[model samples]
Target: MASEDLKTIIENLQKKGKMAFLEKTTPEKIEAFEKENAVTLPEKYKAWLLYSDGGELFLPAGVQFYGIEHKPLLNVNCEDRPSDDYVVIGALASGDPILFKKNSEEVAIYNLEGGKIEEDEKYSDFDAFLIDLPSGILGIGE
Candidate 1:
């Protein structure tokens, strides 16, 4: 779905009093974050961050959408991540990371299985991933 649709979803959730969001951040701050982290964020994801730096979805399932900031509550620099190629943008209630490739829009879920990190699921892009988020959380999609 498009960013507009995502905004609608968030708005509807907000009307229902089911969402919690952080203050919107500036493009300059986002750019500085990219430079400091040595990673380029996807354009669409950046758009979402501009909407709300970070937030929590309380319905369907709890999801933490991380922000590009140093504040512990909004930070996305997950040091225990699997690799430098991936950055954890959000996480599931189960503690599984929702990762995005550095400088790319590709998103995936990295799960710990058999003592190794494995791609449990993958999405072609950030938008597709966000579109399916609720269904994925409800166990209604692959």
Candidate 2:
């Protein structure tokens, strides 16, 4: 989606009780982040960065400024896993976690605290995982 459309969707979601935040990243900052991480961000993630700077993009509590636990995983490397397409974002409510998959296949929800990959299902052809923002819950996971 275009940047403006994404913003609109975020706004609508907030109206429906979803928590969202937006941040605008400058070209210099993006370059610095990449350099610091020593890896390039995926296209979708890059778009997200360009759309806004680092902050809470969607959370009812309102977006916190940079350095408020908004860490980009683009540069943080992970241990080798079976699925090269997987991009584990971070933890969430109820011990359930959120993740993004590179392939346009399915969004994987894992209960890391429970020690299991709870759910794997296809949602759309989009490249990013859209968590159930309002509930701070992911439907795919158990």
Per-model TM against the reference: 0.77, 0.53
Which lDDT values do the candidates have, in the order given?
A: 0.70, 0.45
Candidate that scores best on lDDT: 1
Model 2 has an lDDT value of 0.45
Cα lDDT of model 2 by residue, 73-125, tens digit: 33244432224555444434443434445543444455555555555433332
Candidate 1: C-alpha RMSD after superposition:
3.8
Q: Could you give candidate 1's per-residue lDDT for residues 10-106 as a string of tens digits?
A: 6645554366777888899989988876778888778888887877776546677888662334345676467777888887777787778776788
> Which regions in candidate 1 have their CA more than 4 angstroms from the true location?
1-3, 9-17, 59-61, 70-77, 113-120, 140-142
Candidate 2 Cα misplacement greater than 4 A, ranges? 18-22, 57-87, 101-107, 114-128, 131-142
Tell me, by TM-score, which candidate is best.
1
RMSD of each: 3.8, 5.8
Q: How many backbone clashes does candidate 2 have?
A: 13
